[model samples]
Target: MPDGYSRSSRRLSILQCVLFCALTGGLAASGIVYDYSRTQELARQRLEHTTDLIAQWIIGAFHASDYLLRDLSGLVDTEILQHPHPDPQAQRRLTERLIEKKDSLPHAFLVGAFDRNCIVTHTNAIVGFDASERSYCRALRDDPSAEVFVTPAYVNNLDRINVTQARRLESEMGDFRGMVAIGVDLDFFSAWLDRIDVGRAGSVTIVDSAGLLLARKPMLPEELGQRVVEPRFLEAFASEDEFSAIAGPSPIDGVVRLFGIRQVPDLPFVVVVGEASRELFSDWFWRAVVSTGMIVLLWLLSVLFLRNHLLLVRQRSQLVRVAHFDPLTGIFNRRHFEHLADLAFKHARRAAVPLSLLLLDLDHFKPINDQHGHATGDRALLAFVEASLSVLRETDLFSRWGGDEFVILIEGDEADARILAQRLRAAWARIELRNDQGAPLSLTASIGIAGTHPAVPGELDSLEKLLAQADAALYREKQANR
Candidate 1:
């Protein structure tokens, strides 16, 4: 009769959805984690390849400068070695050549040759200054195999951060003449690194073998010449020249990143490329949002569809129950009772079994309803049905036939039916109901039997005939009570 699901049915639907949502949420979380991990791995591989290419470019650039420096040193050695000491014009030409080389190699920070006395030419300002005390010059002047020496980053006489690249010049007799040194500005390398894309939070760094910072893409001036003491960096620093990749929190910005390190061969610095953890997984955020949203959306749809199905099932069951049962007393209603009784009549006729029908009517029911209320009459009716059910056998069918009337069908003869009706009458008297004022209300029932033991055949042929007989008996009983 109702359009919506009943209270009990609604509660069952909600409980089912809650359990389903929990399972769906767990599955969605697992899927997101798996996707996140796979995406992160792919990003790392891309970053590693990127860093590799950048490292090669940096190494090539530094190597180009080294080759030029070595070539310049050789040219100088060829000039002064053949002549013992070059003439003034020859030395001037050598100075001119050095100036030309400097102009041709734009990457060179400073290009000028210094003599054994530590005096630099072509610079003009420091032409007569002592050069032997300079660390790079001293190293070349003392070490025999110091064909090429790269100094750690340091502040030069000009107060600029730079690293010295030098190659020793020798005489034809294999005696050391001097060294040709070039100071490379650390900023130049940082600028070159800046040209590439390392993402918003990414970075590239160059540090000497001693762990001293040489250049960094996100140039932190204070970090220049500072030792990298972070455990991850220290670990990379202590690693062999084969170059290894690592992952951890960065010491520079304190952000986590995946790091790839490669050393420039024949150079004193290592190239370290870092891809920030956030940037590497940047795309995964939106992917996870959309993916999780879709999962949740689907789950919600399933719940809605399933709830609709449950509502339909409950509605159907409610309709069937409403069709067959008395709403107030929860007993079989008149129409359904007659249908069941018709089936029972046929079964009993075929089996030739003893069949009994008892029709019951409550006595003085109209006066109680007029005095107390219809609500009390309903309570009395329900109390009678409950008490009768307790006294009836499981095989007996008891049904509410109409207002103030009921019927019972059992597999028994007239005597047995009479005994059952007497028992029900006595029990029904003891059953009581509370009125609105909390006063106890009791009632009695008049019952009539339809079948007598060893009755003639065809006497109770149909349910209608049996019911007519029971109704006559019930009228007689009511008159007797009056």
Candidate 2:
């Protein structure tokens, strides 16, 4: 019932609303962080899987090449090598044999064989050029057990980047005869890679086991034969099987890329396939934006719903208070006090316990309002109500009966009612208020008490008779004071 309590309640309600908003925002932020982290992990896994598929495709091409080279090698063993003391006709037969097979081996740009004495046979180029000095010839010569040899990227006699796959030839006595070499134009790989889908700015590369550049899409002539010394490949080299990486500054083009690397089976080569990071994560960007937007919307909805519910509850509480209590003094208003009286009177009549009432009036409330302003008058009324409450028991009903007057219904005898009224008067006398000029103002009240005991009262049989006696006594008290 104090002057500032209602304002304090409003402040508390606002504080609760603020805390609710903060808790909702914090939960939304935590969810977004978790979702984004999960998305990034999934994207990286997708990129790694894509890299593996590209590596496998290139490896499959090499597997096909192996079949072609083996078929040519078999022709040499059965036809020329098995013949003892072979003549020029047999050598010519070997060259004709390669010419026939070359059409079927579409990937091979040139197919040829060289005799043990460094003499060439069945070749498309000049026949007199000794091939024994080439890398493929040395590999077969130095390692008799070597099944195949793969050359690094180099400019062939045709002035194009090419590599070779070779196999050793042996006589029926297992004597070293010569080697069969299949020259492959690496542009075949470039053309194949161009047809495959690897997203925007994606590439496939072939490198020797030494990390030497062999071939790549978006081909660079100056980059051929250069060693790939980037950390990503160096790390991959440590792995014997296929692996992948999200790396920076590609050796071929210096663009950041996601890479997949694997050793070519049964060959001295590695293949690296990659896509640019910008293109690879493009989908993730839109997905992240959409997810964040949904989360924010949900957060806002929760806050709005909570605030609306709280406001509804607050409105209900305010309506209940306004219905039951005096707005200014926060005591029971006349209608609510009368409603409670009907119940209290019925119970009292049944119990036969004595009941009492005190009707009090402020001596000069109207003069105070006229002299000082309505604002100060309102403060004075609030102070008087507070002091009266401090003197009354919880069971007693104190109410604003009308302007500048109040009533207290006591659940006791006449003596108890008089004692409570005296305490209320003394307590109110101590209350202080200030006018607009800030001067202290004092107060007093006149009170009349009535009891249910008919033996001592003029008339007190029913509620109406009891109120009449109280009013009559109050008039007499006012006359005596005048």
Candidate 3:
């Protein structure tokens, strides 16, 4: 009878061991899956953020060149064209201005109606072979409406280097005059892109009008002047959306990456990319390694515990939150703002037109924080962001640029934007609120708007110059109110 009792007890113990083992395995799988899923989400978001930034920056760069060309077109006179072409001295003067104003852009080429072929001018010391005999020149010649042309990234035999930003030239008679090209150093832009927080082995590329590779980061010379994408990128490019993604091993690195794409709508190119690093589940991935080692000897059930409970839900949530929206206002954050801005900037530039960047600040609102409380201040900001969103076009960008400042990128010309701004100001005036003392409170906002002068060329397409002017105006307006 005692033997029988011992046998039954042993059987029960074995059953418990089996169940515990299964549970441990489940928990560990959960953690791994949770880590993987969250990491994937983070990767998606990081790629999206990167796509947006590059798209906007590239868009600005192209638009800057466009404004420069359009302004130059206005500068051309029948007097200049009557000579049948630009003299060497006039050409030198124009080249210097292109370099001086657009340091990122180091060269300019023009093919005028009076010339048999396109003439090139550059800031660099690569002399001779003034014409691109490539298909870009032929394409420009064939397309009559190709008013402002950008050729694909091409390897120039003259300099043994790649030309990054190249546009077309038109005659006073609006003939398929000549192709104007700019030689932008790929090294400079590659270095600039590296400064962004994209993980190891990320790439940023500029393709030309014919869909040929121009500049690539992490330096893919083998892929240079080659067509890399499988037409998926061009399909995405055809749409107005600024951002897109594909999930596959990159042709360059062979690493499985969430590759992102942002089209330079102003140009025929798109920025291709991939991001590095995976998100941490709990900052204890390695700790598990050691703990598993300890458990191997003890035959502990730690594995079962981990596998069941710690998987996908937490990681996915964390990554999605970080990637998609702003932490402060619970709104679409700067990352997303840039994504939308790139799209808007492209459309504006494509039409060979102008756009506006509006900077807005709450008037004397800092005192409200001191007078009331941070809690009240937060509410005011919430209300303010919400109200301003109402006044913007669907294509416009609205973002809280930290603290009391906000920025809006309007998809319209300056005059139309100012009209919208005035309307927003009136909305701000209508808001009524209660302070900490439960007393009625009120405030006004000062807005600064910056727009490109239609006649003047712009070397940099950024809000800084405009914001500076707007802030100055705001100071005067603030002074008047006082």
lDDT of each: 0.77, 0.74, 0.61
Please provide, for model 2 over 357-431, each residue's C-alpha lDDT reduced to its tens digit, 9 standing for 90 to 100: 888888989999999979988998899899999989888888999999888887889899988987887898789
TM-score versus the correct structure, for each prediction: 0.71, 0.69, 0.45
- Tens digits of per-residue lDDT for model 1 on 1-482? 23234656667777887878887888888888998889766766775676667667767776787788877876674435322334667767877787677666665667767766556754423454566777788888888777778777777777777787887877767667777877777665776676778888888888887788878878798888788888777777767754677888888778898887776666667778888888877787888898789878988797888778776877787787799888898878888888887787767767777789999888889988999999888888878888899899878988888888889998888888989988997888789687889988778888888983223554757777778999999999888888
Residues forming the 10-long window of minimal summed lDDT in candidate 1: 77-86
Residue 15 displacement in candidate 1 (angstroms): 5.4
Candidate ranking under TM-score, highest first, comes to: 1, 2, 3
Q: Give the clash count for each candidate.
A: 1, 1, 18
What overall lDDT, based on C-alpha atoms, would model 2 receive against the true structure? 0.74
Best of the candidates, TM-score: 1
Where model 3 places Cα greater than 4 Å from the true spot, the runs are 1-6, 78-145, 157-159, 164-181, 199-261, 276-482
